[model samples]
Target: MKHFFIEELLPKAGGSVYRLTRMAARRALELSEGRPSLMRKPSSDKVTTIALEEIAEGRIVYNKEASSVSSKDSTSPRAVLMRGNLASSQEKASVS
Candidate 1:
């Protein structure tokens, strides 16, 4: 079992704990429904734990669009990286 602090997770959900809970719940449900985990080796077999690990590790990107159904729009789920929201993956990993 891992301990997840609110401070570590708040920004991932746009600083809203409610959204965090909602997002986590939704991801957890997907895992329970047999969705494959994004993690190479999930921390646990438990669906909820796997979901949280995904979120914590930045494997899950938050869909900013208010309307969940947005295939016609942006905000695609199951994306590995959200360019606008975080540091570019291509940027050199050197601390300045």
Candidate 2:
């Protein structure tokens, strides 16, 4: 089973994203299994409910590093070199 944050669900429901009220969060937790609740106060009047699963842990990895690479003259020479090596290796393998 996958846990979803209430705020995450809002986009899926096509509703305005807002913090889930404690009442709302509690209700959702009560109805669901094995999911933890995260509460956030976004404003004086509104408290947002974010589920633990909805929050990103920290970093994200993408397989296509080329999209993230900047320009030919990027500061990270090692990364660029590695990408070029991989591309060249692929081309050579494909040609063979």
TM-score of 1: 0.67
CA RMSD of all predictions: 13.3, 15.8
Q: 1-96, model 1: which lDDT tens digit per residue? A: 877888998887788898777767777877777667777798789888887777788766575764231112234454323223234533645453
Residue runs of model 1 more than 4 Å from their true location after superposition:
65-96
lDDT of 2 by residue, 35-92 (tens): 3223233112221223222222211111233523122234643212111355778999
Pick the TM-score winner: 1
Query: Model 1, residue 77: what's the lDDT?
Result: 58
Please give the distance, in angstroms, between residue 37's alpha carbon in candidate 2 and its true position after superposition: 27
